[model samples]
Target: MKLVQKWTVFMLGLLVVSFGIVLTIRAELGVAPWDVFHIGLSNQFSFTVGRAGQVTGFVIILLSFVVGKIKPTLGTIANILLIGFMIDLLMLVVSSPTNLIIRYFYLILGTVIFGFGAGLYISAHCGTGPRDSLMMALDKNLSYDISIIRGGIEVGALSIGYILGGPVGIGTILIALGIGPIVGLSLNKVNQLKNKLQPKIDCYN
Candidate 1:
């Protein structure tokens, strides 16, 4: 890829995160499971989720590093900024949904957008997001199946969110279930894209 195109992809990743933020606030159904926890923490402690995400990412990245995992890279930076950007977008422009239907639709939108963004940035082979990091940690430490482990993560996070004063409703449950399929679809596309790019990169080398 040309320098210009690579730069474009990087910038697009940021936009995708910003878009996710808007969808989240507009969804107003409450944040997705992990985000619900972050938001709840933020609300209770008077910190924004984005800032919390960054701090969480820093800790997770350090832990992963200590484990001899992938070193930090631009995707790591993106993960940090993405949530921060979302928080800023939330504070600046987006508003809560007015009704249940709109709220649900907003969550669906947020899921798709967030999944797509995560797919793209993750495909960069840089680093996983903070939430993804937490999920992987659970999967590793508990030696559980991905589905079961992820389910536990969501259930645990949502419960924490509930305790922390985040909204929990049908949407919370829906998002927990819905995010997996949507993200799987998005990541499949990203994997295909990565496969297609590999030969070109290999050729250049």
Candidate 2:
């Protein structure tokens, strides 16, 4: 039952994250750095954004394993497969808001939702997502602060994405600045909740 519950929460978190990604795209305001890279691939390669993400994620997972010796977990595999599919499915129905204000609203809301979703899944302790795994791998090998590694990766992604003609705007800036703090806060809160519940969950066993 605990295993079932954990996976349920993990899947739910991915679903929410996918919806958040689609919302950001629909806003047309720009997207997170890695997402910018995915969108760039979609534009250049004639793939859907979600398909592009899946391909990119697969490559990253491979690299993480090969170079970083990071084994893929079940959660990581699910993340690679499911988030992209969910994003594609949601994008079909979620329309762009024409109003500038509403677009900004979508941008912010999407970022927050994405953060919380990330927090929920991460706190489940199943595994880190592909990109995050890659970051951890890099941190292990390079011995750089995780923040520096993450920032470097995002900057690199953003640069390539911009060159590939992905959308770049204020929303990109907002996501870069806001997502960390939001995810941090959400993760802290979710972990706290989980800690509180764990004893009761264990009592059942």
Candidate 3:
């Protein structure tokens, strides 16, 4: 695929991801570890969650580059700049539901959508966001198991976020347990779709 096309996909996927994130937030049940951190920062600083996320992403990018020697790619830069803004924008319109069933629906739907969005962006072959970059760096530098590294990072984030007054509940546990399998499934589907489309794309090219 062309560079522009790849960027288009990346941006679109980020938009979808942001929408999904907003849905989860609106559900008011809880959020992912990184999101908990973002929300905590927002609450502490009196800023939007998106702004908090942007600042966090910027810091992580710097740490990844300086400490881990991981260069930020175009996609990485875009991911930092775009997703947070989109999330804040979405939040302006997406209000939390008062009904219990509806809130759970939002949480579940958001999780699936988030997973699909992740798959789409990953399949674009641009680059990963700051958090993933950090994970890779830690895995490489620490010589630890990747799962252990990831779990450590997330648990640390979760702890800090909770201390900072972020919400924690069943939704957090649900996301933690369910997101991996959902993302795996979404990636498989995205790959299959990409494979099927490749021949058509080649013909057009």
Candidate 4:
């Protein structure tokens, strides 16, 4: 059933996001590169992560509409809501870091959870999120190894976060090193499950 499939995707997406948040909470030092940049930009302009994320999502969605012919979809709206809501909620549960170590752990857990959600939520292929759009664009433009390009983009984002007052601590480091593989593994697993459980679905690309 379409409803059942969407439900499964929603639940899995929640788990993935929760896991990433855990990492973010644990990586006490700071955020990974991209988040750091986004958070940093938010701070420089006196905005919350949720607001920034939504704004960014809107901008990227518009761009996608122009370039890739991506029409508005429920999943796209969900992406904006999901990130914005969680970032706001986290401001309550994840406190300002007292030390570098605390931030390190928070970020690590958050990254894992985030990656997990990316794999699960993205399987729906309803639409790509803001951050993902940037990556896909870079992947096409650079015409080189995707992982390397991604790493470069992350570093740039982290630098921006540093300037914006985001935590550029141990958490950032852990994410730079670990989060990619976790996402890849999760995507692979999700794909396998999809193939076995429902072969007719054409969600994943």
User: Per-residue lDDT tens digits of candidate 3, residues 1-205?
Assistant: 5667777877888998898889888999999898999988888997899999999998988888777899899889899889989999999999999999999999999988888888878778788899988898787689789999989999998999898988888789988998889888977987787778777662111
* Model 1 misplaced regions, further than 4 Å: 1-7, 63-74, 135-142, 190-205
Q: After TM-score superposition, what is the CA distance of residue 93 in candidate 3 from its true location, in Å?
A: 0.7
Global local distance difference test of model 2: 0.87
> Regarding TM-score, does 1 or 3 come out ahead?
3
Candidate 1: residue 78 lDDT (0-100): 70
Cα-based lDDT for every prediction = 0.66, 0.87, 0.86, 0.69
Over 4 Å off in model 2, which ranges?
A: 202-205
Q: Which predicted model would earn the best lDDT? A: 2
Rank by TM-score (best first): 3, 2, 1, 4
lDDT of 2 by residue, 61-148 (tens): 8999888899999888899899999998998999999999999899989999988888877767777889898998898899788999
Task: State which candidate, 2 or 4, has the greater lDDT.
Answer: 2
lDDT of candidate model 3 versus the reference: 0.86
- TM-scores of all models? 0.75, 0.93, 0.95, 0.74
Q: Which candidate leads in TM-score?
A: 3
lDDT of 4 by residue, 1-205 (tens): 6766665686568556744754574455666676776677787887777777677678866775666555656766777777677767766675656776655555655777788887787676666666566666656556778778767766776776787787776666777778779879888998898787666664444
lDDT of 1 by residue, 124-154 (tens): 5555665566566555666678888667866
